[model samples]
Target: MRYAKSADGARIAYSAGGAGEPLLLLAGQGNTHHWWDGVLDDFRAAHRTITLDYRGTGDSDRPDEPYSTEGFAEDAIAVLDDLGVERAHVYGTSMGGRVAQWLAARRPDRVRALVLGCTSPGGPNAVDRGDDVRRSLARPAPEGRRRALLELMYTPGWLATHPGPYRTLGDPTMTPKERLRHLVASERHDAWDALPGIQAPTLVVHGDDDLLNPTANAALLAERVPGARLCLIPGARHAYFEESRSVAGPLVLDFLREHERA
Candidate 1:
């Protein structure tokens, strides 16, 4: 694991693999760099993929205080700076997508393109997962919580094909507290009005059956961002990356490639 010092001087943990145009991956809340395990190979095939564990999650330094989405964005920028990457395609999922949007809006020149998956603009229409979902997320990882999370994240067909490293759910390494903090940060984020400010070429991908962020959020993003394309994966759910990597991977790679060529 490598480290980058954020503006706030917090050391962020990240890993770089593959070799090609730089592609920084910002993971969703509660997730660490390992969360991208499902799609890493595909991304690595075409780009130098950098996967990071956000502050207070995974192996990154966790500061005791209120976490802000803006802080996550700064951490991303710090990672890029540490790697000497002036500009690169930025792809984020879920909460990570929120951070990516902020990064593109605030540091337009540093972002070559944007790919938002299963995320929202934090607008009025943003879907909330309800108290049950929130309670489930907040409580300790019960025996079936991981599977339940997988169900909410992906469609049944997806779960059938790729069962995932399910054993990890019970692994001692999982951090429930950090995950709860991530949920808190996500609930507080409100970037709806800032969508138009993102200048980078953007692609919004969502699952038609996504109950977490809802498919409408993707529509909101496409509608707000001029020329931003939207792709709705049929029957997929919030965790589209794990659910339909064959589909999501190609679509993401294609977008990055198209922009790189232009």
Candidate 2:
């Protein structure tokens, strides 16, 4: 993993490999770049894939102070700049998608396209998560967290049948304070007004069975973002990008390839 120095001089850890157009994977809250391990090779086959750990996750530096989604976006852009990439096709999931909205909205020239999965626009349009999800958001028990998260992330039938898809719920890397701070940033994120200004072609993907953010949020992204397309996977849930990689990987690759730089 390589590290980039953010504008604030925080060391942002990231890993990038492969060829073709660059594709940045901004992971969800409380996750590291390793979160994309399930489908990294598949992406590498066609594009240069770069995934980074947010400020407090994985090998990245964990600053003690609070951070907002906008600040996180700056860190994301810093990763791109450190790599000398002028623009990229970005894919963000959950809170990462929320960060992507701010990045694409605020820095149109740096984004060629966007894929927002299992995320929301925030404000009144944002759907409140269920009790079980709210309880486990960032403060998760390593042993049961994967199982618990899977229950909320994938459909019951899929969970019963599949084994490898829901194994990792992230390493317990963040401290209690870091976890709560991340949640607070997530709660305060409001991209409802900023999305319409995004200049890149966008795709909003979600699982019909998603409960945490709800599939309704995906619809909001599609409706609000100009020229954005929406794809809702049947029988999938919040972790569709990982749990349903076969479906989502190809769809996202197709979308990015369609809009790849000339």
- The root-mean-square deviation over C-alpha atoms between each candidate and the true structure, in angstroms, is 2.4, 2.2
- What ranges in model 2 sit over 4 Å off? 131-146, 161-168
On the 0 to 100 scale, the lDDT of residue 148 in model 1 is 69
lDDT of each: 0.82, 0.87
Report the lDDT tens digits of candidate 1 across residue range 146-199: 666767876676568865664113223546676666767887888878888889
Best candidate, TM-score: 2
- Candidate 1 lands at a TM-score of 0.91
Query: Any runs in candidate 1 off by more than 4 Å, and if so which?
Result: 123-125, 130-141, 166-176
Candidate 2 structure quality by residue, lDDT tens digits, 1-262: 8999999999999999999999999887887877788789999999989999899888999998998899999999999999999999989999999999999999999999999999999888777777877677445566565566767877777777877643346547788788877888888999988988998999999999888788888888999999999999987888898778989999999999899777
